[model samples]
Target: MSEKLGAERLMPNEWRDDLEALDLEIVRFAIICQVKLLEPGVIQRVLDNDARDCIHGNQTAFASLRGLLFLHFQMQKDLAEAYGPSDATEIVRRVWAHLQPRVGDQLGSLPNPGALSAV
Candidate 1:
């Protein structure tokens, strides 16, 4: 058996730390789903649901719990690693802005970390 599969290693595409650069055509096409694609709020809900399942002793909850924990911790690590925890709320607001493009930028861009305004 061969050590390698039928493939060649492609270019490494860690988006050089600038979210804005994704606006370019080539850069935009080179989409990679990272923490950017996930909405922290939704991840929170999934975590919450998984916790509840754990409480109820769902048969598969243990595996689900482990994955969720990794995801949870990873998100925390990502925040501390990329932008300090202080900026977590701002990140959420930026998500909200994308969610409601009709809203004016100034207002839509306000940071409401824990509190999502009524749509």
Candidate 2:
């Protein structure tokens, strides 16, 4: 990844012109997983309160944004309080905790606890 920060991590097209909550969830998932699964834009924009633009004027998108923000802050506070000041290390652990590895991801890598490798 580039040495640049969050917004800098995104490709031009990765940014969502829309502020739908589901769309923003993609970004939140990226953050929690600690992997750049998407070319995510900056979290600052994702967290913007005034960015609510729901199609049909429904509140789902706005509600989703609120939930996402709550989750982000809660996780931040939880990790800090639980793990002390080891942000980097704790983040790695958090990523793995949330990881849903595909078979391809594990074919030759991580071993399953009780499963034998195919010969």
Candidate 3:
């Protein structure tokens, strides 16, 4: 008799989709970060909260996160140039508020850190 493979053992395209989804999450987070940066008070609050601790400790992960941060900064700069710095922050904040929950859901679907570490 042949043994049956479980769903976990079966390869699925969901993994790739999940990764792509993660990229989108990072983009969304970056946008929020940009909005937060626009307000010195908000940026100070975020730094005081030590939110960086949530990021992965690995160098590659850090670099990837930094890249996303830079992307958001650039996006903010572009918007400011086009729409005026006075209103760019508000626009970013609104866009981020819409994107945040979707990103959170996608991130929540990913495997936990321990599972990734085991691999």
Candidate 4:
């Protein structure tokens, strides 16, 4: 059998760390969107404005916007797959219920260790 298929080929620590960081950032973004500090649609408006500019903006700007949208949709897919489909309100409730204890006083929470397996 190939070494790549062997148990020793488990993911490297750096990749694991990167995944953890991404998960934390995703959760933080979600929390920020929930807080009332920003008016509703403010985020969407910002993204839309950037997107408009990207039409004539440099490649880096377009790539940045594309990356952001990819991450956004990826989070949505992960949430649905992890918690199942439901109203947005119910999904938010489930997300917090899963996260609150794990995060406690922290600004944001990482997924429960090993929760990434499903993701």
Candidate 5:
């Protein structure tokens, strides 16, 4: 979170606060998305692209980095453009919850939602 904005260092506390707020918003949207019970197509495309990268020799670690970038930046951008920011936020939340449990269970550990968001 110490990334620079222009010349000033991004304050750690403020960055964390922003991240936490984002996490809460995402959680709320996720709950709403779950009620709808269908994965947004945009999310699917992001996952698909990640899978393609893995198949083309991207290491798991790098693939994860790419996935994060796509989800937080690209996916949000695309969803917001197509559906507006508020709706896009909901989709992000839904996609987060939808993906997390499935991936975690497959790896034999169901992550507590929000457990690692602060880190």
Candidate 6:
């Protein structure tokens, strides 16, 4: 028999849009880090804000973005542990490039995370 569909399965197309927005946020963060140095605390705040907004009204998309972000950080940490600091930045750059296409134009005009540091 076919699996029964639940109410939760009926997500609106907006949620996909939200996920794409979240992806753009991640890409912005990566770009800022590339151009200028950002403090760790600053980076954390940006990620926290993105996660919070994503979580507030859209749980499913938020959860997915959170998971992806977590995995991204974990993989970066693992690579750092294995290859040393010199290689960590390059790995992160490549990862960000891979993610950019997936997010496409959904990012809108969100501020770069690094810019937040000055505020």
Candidate 1 local lDDT, 31-112, one digit each (tens): 1111111233433443454433223444353444445444434543454345555554455345444444433331223344
lDDT per residue for candidate 6 within 1-119, as digits (tens), equals 66535322323333234334544565554443331113334335434644333313444544444455555465445444655544554544444455546644434332443232122
Q: Which stretches in model 3 have alpha-carbon errors above 4 Å?
A: 1-55, 103-119
Compose the digit string of candidate 5's lDDT tens values, residues 1-119. Answer: 55544312333334334444454444344332321112323234334543331223435443443345344555345445655666556554555565555434322232343222212
> What's every prediction's RMSD, in angstroms?
13.1, 16.7, 16.8, 10.3, 14.0, 13.2
Q: TM-score of each candidate?
A: 0.29, 0.35, 0.42, 0.30, 0.32, 0.42
Candidate 3 has its poorest 10 consecutive residues by lDDT at 110-119
Clashing pairs in 3: none
User: Could you tell me which residue pairs clash in candidate 4?
Assistant: none
> Residue 53 of candidate 5: its Cα lDDT?
19
Each model's lDDT comes to 0.34, 0.37, 0.43, 0.41, 0.40, 0.43
lDDT score at residue 114, model 1, on the 0-100 scale: 44
Model 2 global lDDT (CA atoms, 0 to 1): 0.37
lDDT for model 6 comes to 0.43
What C-alpha lDDT does candidate 1 achieve relative to the native structure?
0.34
> Candidate 1: which pairs clash?
none
- What stretches of model 2 exceed 4 Å from their correct place? 1-41, 52-59, 87-89, 92-119
List candidate 6 stretches off by more than 4 Å. 1-52, 98-105, 108-119
Question: What's the lDDT of the predicted structure labeled candidate 5?
Answer: 0.40
Model 3 lDDT tens row, 9-114: 3223332333334446555553444332222233333334434533433444444555654444555555456556655555554554455566554333323222
